[model samples]
Target: ARAYRMEWPADMTVFEIDQPQVIEFKATTLAGLGAAPRAELCTVPIDLRQDWPKALLDAGLDRNRPIAWIAEGLFGYLPPAAQDRLLDNVTALSAHGSRLACEAVPDMSQVDHDQAREMMRRVTAKWREHGFDFEFADLGYEGERADVASYLDNLGWRTVGKPMSRLLADNGLAAIPQSNDSVSVADTVYYSATLSK
Candidate 1:
């Protein structure tokens, strides 16, 4: 960047990408609270399933520089193909040395459908009482899917994955109860990776 005379900001610009409605709501709420972020924050409103890489570039992301990407609580919300596309997009946009961290949910087909449905029923019922009723099962895709870590590994990312329970125990925290139930997240795997030069 210095060689090219790119006028990148002294402070790193953190981009937060999400749905248009979500971005709007967040902006409104933040304005209402007079909240301020410590760093330069750019909120990009675009559907992840669409041409988000272009949208992000338009929002001033510097692909020439290393980007630390986080896919927190994101993949399960998308269909398997969309999830794969998202990963591809991220990998394509990243420069060498760019790092990524994501929380990977198990393949939905491996989960207990009946148990998941019952759990969602109880949770959605409570939301309906509060006038915010929506079916996640309808929004979130469910079926067999490729493992995130393996997929990224094939794309040339040096990867490391650990279960949430293992992370907790390593941090000296009490472990969450392990279960085969869909609602239990103790076994959720988190992956961190870097694209090497």
Candidate 2:
């Protein structure tokens, strides 16, 4: 859809990386909708925890060119070490001026883990009621993690971040009220980083 809206750039290729089942399901859904990719689309079916970097490169990712990577709702599913490793891999593969946009979870030191978990459960239950059955707790790895901005800054990437409430306000939307659960959208911190040339 994005490519179509942009009139399909011939020089650009979009890579979709995920587990085999997810890739298959996405393909099926797109085909069922009678949709075709407007730009070159390559699907790499593999778990992110595996050697996905190699798999991506094998699928013809051009590391020499600036890349734009988006990790929407991804880090919360990975362990702290895995998150660091993922960033390391991306930094290594990225050429100068590469861009990364990701969701950076907050430091949960002051958050009540039990309360947060319960609230998250409630959110997931509501989602299930609406036909979104993905298990938030079962798939997530909760605990302490490094500050994404600091990590990227040390890695020579200039980054800007905004919390969910700020994002809403900046975009002229009313902020959703959040309780002490800390697991709500109040905890969402999005970061956009660019590797310096």
- The lDDT leader among the candidates is 2
Candidate 1: what lDDT? 0.82
**Candidate 1: lDDT of 118?**
78
Q: Highest TM-score: give the candidate number.
A: 2
Can you tell me which runs of candidate 2 are displaced by over 4 Å? Answer: 1-8, 131-135
lDDT of 1 by residue, 1-197 (tens): 11122344668687888999988987787778777665677888888767889989998999999998989899878878888898888999999999999998765666678889877777788888999869755766777778998899998899999988899999999989665556577768999999976
Clashing pairs in 2: none
Give the Å shift of residue 143 in candidate 1. 1.3
Q: How does candidate 2 fare on TM-score? A: 0.91
